[model samples]
Target: MKKVILLSMVTLAMISCNKETQAVEKVKTAYIDTSKLLEENNEAKDIEEKYKVKSEEMGRELRAEASRFQNEAASFQQNAMAKGQAWAQAKGAELQKREQELGMKQQAMLQTLQQESGKEMDSLVKRIKDYVKDYGKKNGYDYIYGTGDAATVLYAKEAYDITTTISKELNDKYKGSEKKEEAPKEEAKK
Candidate 1:
């Protein structure tokens, strides 16, 4: 009876160990190249283009204002001697005030652009993270790591890299959304 009990316990232990090993092997994992994902994602590209256009427009406006200020300064320099010391002093003070105001506007514009861009980028990153989380859940991925810049994974097999797959999916989703948005505008026009 003692021999039979001991043999039974040994077999049960082996069976449990085999099941645990199989469970570990069944876990699915993947890694995404963070930089590549952003580079390839259509929405990210659109955001970049949108900001670029905004920056250029703001730059042109600022440049035009600066050019006007420059013209005024040039005019003052040409007429300062004829205008007399008191007039020159007053005009010089006024120009200095204008320059300071221009400087403040430039600084404020830069700060606002940076803040807006940062907020949009942060939101985009959050969306990407949520998408990845949902993707993992749907696809039965036990873990998904990020690799690039601030990499979370040091090395992974090429087979395990899902950057391209995710990028393509994201691009397709973005295109679908663009079409949907355009459809509404088209209807509005009709």
Candidate 2:
């Protein structure tokens, strides 16, 4: 009778252990391709387009200023012989000063662009991280890893890739948020 009870208890213990193992195995894990997420992400694209336009505008402004300076330089060169050494030297010095000022302005504009872009990119990263955190919470995922060229995760099953799923969700959410922003402006215009 003791042998029978011992066997039953061992069987029960084995079954319970198996159940616990299955429970542990059920932990949800997935990964997103960070590069793909950034590339395909609508918010990221919008930010890029905005910067592209701003860069173009700045380029045009710089070009116009350069053209004006070039015309002055050409005029100075043409009249340098007639204007005498003193006049030519003074004009050259003025042109050099103007060139230096323009160079400084260009540097300032570029620095401003870089600083703004860095801050914006940082904000975008935070936003993405927050979105991912919310997504993990909502989906009951134990882990949602990020992978890319700078891969945090080396290997994961293709079946466990949530890149497409989460990217679509993020884009959809961005679109909805964009509409809300536009609605306020439209109402304000009224």
Maximum-lDDT candidate:
1
User: Candidate 2, residues 1-190: lDDT per residue as tens digits?
Assistant: 9999999999999999999999999999999999999999998898888888888899899989999999999999999999899999999999999999999989988888888888888898899999999999998999999999889998899999999998999899999999999999999999
Model 1: per-residue Cα lDDT over 26-131, one tens digit each:
9999999999999998888888898889988998999999999999999999999998999999999999999999999999988988899888889989999999
Pairs that clash in candidate 1: none
Error of 1 at 91 (Å): 1.1
Q: CA lDDT, every prediction?
A: 0.95, 0.93
List ranges where model 2 is wrong by over 4 Å. Answer: 1-24
Query: Where's the lowest-lDDT run of ten residues in candidate 1?
Result: 42-51
